[model samples]
Target: TVFLTTHFMDEAQALADRLAIIADGMIVATGSADELIGAGSTNTRIRFRLPETSQLPDTFEARRDISAWELETDTPTRTLHELTEWALGTETELLDLEVTRRSLEDVYLQLTAEAAEP
Candidate 1:
């Protein structure tokens, strides 16, 4: 077993198989990167732009901005598949599609912030 301490989150995520966050001289959180990120209420977000005239399927719950729509779901694979199928069926185009997940840095910051809170 190897123990390493560093302020670089990317390095820790890359090299460590398991990680424990120490805050206030105490162990605040411990887990694999995926486990730590998933433990928080962090959902994968799918953001895209569709034609103003087009409407998304009812199965997908999305919020719309001026020209874009965003969907947050834990099941990104199935949600993406369903979205693509629906788009293909209706010949609608999804523009500027992006999928985002909670990163190790995000989880680390959240944990440290919580630890600092009174």
Candidate 2:
């Protein structure tokens, strides 16, 4: 059995067959990367940008700049489908779109944050 400790979640995910998260001098959680990430409500994250001329829908939580917008969603597949349809309907260009799963680091942070709460 190898006992290792580090603050780097990415390193833990990469090196460990089983991962443990310690917080406040206690073992808060333990699992593999997939297990930990799957336990969360948000399994997927979608990020995207639309053209400056495009109008953002009220359902989307987005941050806008001069020429682009960024947004994240928990349901990537459904959201992507809806977004694509919306883009087609609105005649907007979808730019800089990225879809990713919730990382081990995100799970670690969420667990630690919850542990810190009273």
Using all chains and alpha carbons, the TM-scores for the candidates as numbered come to 0.62, 0.83
Q: What local lDDT score does residue 92 receive in model 1, on the 0 to 100 scale? A: 97
> What alpha-carbon RMSD in Å does predicted model 1 have with respect to the real structure?
3.6
Model 1 — which ten-residue stretch has the worst lDDT? 36-45
lDDT of 1 by residue, 7-38 (tens): 89899989999999988999988999888889
Q: What lDDT is reached at residue 62 by model 2?
A: 69
Best candidate (score: lDDT)? 1
Off by over 4 Å in 2: 61-74
lDDT of each: 0.88, 0.81
Question: How many clashing pairs does model 2 include?
Answer: 0
